[model samples]
Target: MSKNYHFIAIGGAVMHNLALALLSKGYQVSGSDDEIYEPSRSRLKAAGILPEEKGWFPDKIHQGLDGIILGMHARIDNPELIRAKALNIPIFSFPAFIYEQSKEKKRVVISGSHGKTTITSMVLHVLKSCGLDFDYLVGAQIEGFDLMVRLSDAPIIIIEGDEYLTSPLDRRPKFFHYHHHILLMSGIAWDHFNVFPTFENYVDQFSQLAAMTPEKGAFIFYEDDPNVKKIAAEVPNTVRKTPYREHPAVIKAGQTYLLTKKGELPISVFGQHNLQNLQGAWEICQNLGITADQFYESIASFKGAAKRQQILAKSDDSILFRDFAHAPSKLKATVEAVKVQYPDRKLIAVQELHTYSSLNKDFVHNYAHTFDAADVAIIYLNPKAVSLKKLELMDESTLRSGFKRNDLILFTETKKLKSYLENQIYQNCNLLLMSSGNYDDMDLTTLQKTINKQHS
Candidate 1:
């Protein structure tokens, strides 16, 4: 019999994909969401799996339903979730369901503070390109891949292993559930302040994830990252440990080309960190018995994960990019990557203090000297964000003092920030805007185009 499943907070990026995958597999699926956005709304509507407009319907939960899959957005008291709980029916978080589905398949989990999506997407792209059928759960909307979640009769499944709690109820790390045959740790740095309060605590989460890999499995890591190295060395087991570093590459005509041991490979994805990600992906595929030639062929067309060093617009002289780099380490790495990628171009690095941790006057010091590569560094934090996230409102003095960049400009209003950016000459310059949230719904794409027009 076909399984009947209901999703709490079905409007989420990963949740919607899971619903679609189940629907494709002929499961009776229903879902609820307070709001819906692009791709999810259209995709759900097309698949005939969308919730009827807006809200949690407790009546939707029933005893006959096989299981309820919950998203992180759904509160513990979510009406639909509460209804499912009362029924004592099987409930599965999305990650839990993935583990349930891929129990027998060889699981390849990509875990780290940053580059999880990129590394996972790379593995998925190569696997698909080589016609090696495999299921996957990646965070971003990857091109060539239609959805974020895929399930099939394939013998393998690769997942972007987020170190955050599995669910509000689970309290376990999301990556802990999967039966990992192959594990890759890109790097570990302090992140998700709400989850792990201290730097050491945040580092320990990766260590725990590493230990979860079976003794027969393989643990792939980026040895360049000291934190990743520290955790990799401690996981004392026969889990065949493989280390990867940045591949040889040269920047030419504003394009980056990688020089593999076999030959020079040109791929659209750039930066030393991304190069490291490619190496990790290649090694994971290699451990899975994929040939070196196959990995390179698939990576040729790979652009990148959405918002991870994604180019917004470009002109001969000016280029603008955006990234989901809110955490201190990610922000620093992203800035450094861009500066290195285009050394001749002046970099104007801008970041929005969107996360609760980043806005915290106490935690703000973590971002110190992160944007030192940029010719001009600007920190944009919305006052409304401070109130919404329930964080202490920081003064310009406090915010500036925390980042410790003396010449940094700070702004609370989009108009003032826009004005400041508009006046800047972008000649031979690159504008990098990093945030995990919209800058108060400011259209950065339009702004990038406007800036490009001025310079053109």
Candidate 2:
């Protein structure tokens, strides 16, 4: 059955991918976004579904459409939405629509504040490595996979479940919509302060996700996280409960090797968080009928997802890494990982406070002591970004008080930050740039080239 689907705000990373996926399935796909950005715009253009013009038209929302998939960027009072409501046209949030499509297939959802993308990518990598045919919806771009979302006749679907709100209209957390046949939670940490006001409120969302899992389903979680442990305890006995911790590994000479019963298995990824993610992925694979040996073999080749502790540049004396670590828990883990991996090298950690939660005055205190592992800590925030987000301006004193680090260097200008970094003595220092956004659009590759030129 060829269905006519319309997407509102299809410029989003996940939304655009889903639109392409539906088009690939022989469905007629049409979409409109107020403004489309790179990659998404280009991808949509290539697929021939790119809207001729920008803004939405109520005429697009008609009775002939099978369903309208809404993106988070669309507003409640959007003209298209108003028309759809008037016509009583069925509308679905991306997450809700994903559930609708995969209801018949076995859904394996990886959910948590951190490591969901890594774990989901790990599972996809392993499944593909084992020659298994499956559909998947991961957050980040994986190395081997061209598309982030895939839909097919595959009996199993792997999803990277986010706890963030599904859409502007759908206030429920995205993960709550995924009734998992197999659920894996890496850990829980308070984030999205705008949506979830308090730590307790944020934690409750994960608990609700656990409660929604069917009795016949399996709930796998990282036992190391106290919050996860609590969630595990609350699950019904009818649900199979499995717990995992960081995989045992030996770090020798700045290289990490997993110590499996099969002996030392060299993997492309490192850090305790990644090890824990790997363990969670291993458990998920085991439940999916993949043997331990097979899991180990496939995981060894896993290079990790993009921007999750990705190596930007490396030299004998100094190495540079860029990671998407906006949250406090993620910041602590990422910095600790780099310091632990290269114990001999001094670590200079630079993080950008770009996200809404990170920029919020009330939420800033959660980041206290997160940069203790770094020899030198620097934080950057663009005042323009704060103004655009309509957030109160955060001065250096407020940031200093928040992190409680007297020696912390703060920057409001990208040029100053870049100049400071370039002038730094990088003899034996590892530079780690952590941010969900690029540091005010600074060209990291250009900076890396300059740094290499200086040292060479």
Candidate 3:
């Protein structure tokens, strides 16, 4: 008989994908969410798993269900959760359930403040190219993959481990549950201030994750990041510790090519950070029995994960790109990457202060000089977001002083920001939209059309 599983708050990015994965695996899947966003909603509707209504139904839970998967969006007092507890049904957090599903396989977990998605996607692409069977759970939708989560009877599973809280009922970090046999630490920067509350608290989670690697397992880290270095040094000698640096590459006429003994090979992605990501992926692939030559050959066609340096439109003189860079370290790396990748073109970088940490007056100071590489820096924060998050209202002076950029342009209204961008001359310039949000629902297609016209 097929196992029956129900998802609470299943409309999330990974939650919906996980639902579809189970359905594909022949499990009887059902789910509910108080709110469902695009792509998730559309995908769930297509799969016939989308909730008929917007809210939860306690009657949906019963003793007949095999298991219950909980998402972080649900509250401790959620009615469905109460019913599940009363019925003594097994409740698994997103990461916990993923760990359960892949327990028999060798788990390669990618953990850090940034670059987890890129590295995971790179490994998946290479594995597919080599015709190796593997399951994966990446944060974003890659260029060629249809879903972000997959579960099968493969020998190995590649998981993008996150440091965020697992669920409302379980306060432990998500990565803590993965129990990785092989661990990769991309880099560490303090984030999720609302949960961790301090830099030391945030770093402690990574330390614990490093300690979780089995004695015979491998722990890979970026050698350059000081935070990663400190964590790597503390891990016991029983675990194999490997370090990776940026791949040797050269940029010619706006294209980045890896310098290999086989010769210079062009790739679809650019930036030093991405090269570092590639190196990390290569190290993991090596452990998985893929040869260096095979890895390089497969990586050449890897465009990138969605919203990680995703190009929206391009012309000879100008290009517009969007990235999900909200943290200070990621913001700085992305800005510098673009500027260094195209030295001749001016960089007009705009980022939205959407995350809870970014909008906090106390955390704002961390962003100091992050946008220094850009020729033009613009910051946007929707005023209603402040109220919605119940944070202290931020003023222009606080943001300017926090970023320490006297000339930074600040906008609170999406309309004004769009108008300001539409009026700019994009000739010989690059426009970078960096945010975890959509600039308060700004339409990208219309903006792309307007900007492409200006560039032409």
Top candidate when judged by TM-score against the true structure: 3
What are the per-residue Cα lDDT tens digits for candidate 3 across 33-149?
999999899899999999999998999999989999999999999999999999999999989999999999999999999899999999999999999999999999887788898
Candidate 1 lDDT by residue in tens digits, 353-427:
898789888888888888888889998989888898887777767866888877888888998887788777877
Please give the lDDT score for candidate 3. Answer: 0.93
User: On a 0 to 1 TM-score scale, where does candidate 1 land against the true structure?
Assistant: 0.95
Off by over 4 Å in 2: 451-456
The CA lDDT at 406 in model 1 is 75
Mind giving the per-residue lDDT tens digits that candidate 2 earns over 136-238?
9999889999889999999999999999998888798998887899999899888999989888999999999999889789999999899999999999999
Q: In terms of lDDT, which candidate is strongest?
A: 3
Q: Each prediction's Cα lDDT score?
A: 0.85, 0.91, 0.93
CA displacement after TM-score superposition, residue 373 of candidate 2 (Å): 0.9
- Give residue 323's lDDT in candidate 3 (0 to 100): 95
- RMSD (CA, Å), candidate 1 to true, equals 1.8
Q: For candidate 2, give the lDDT of residue 318.
A: 83
Worst lDDT 10-window in candidate 2: 446-455
> Considering only N, C-alpha and C atoms within 3 Å, which residue pairs clash in candidate 2?
none
Residue 23 alpha-carbon offset, candidate 3, angstroms? 0.5
Tell me which of candidates 2 and 3 scores higher on lDDT.
3
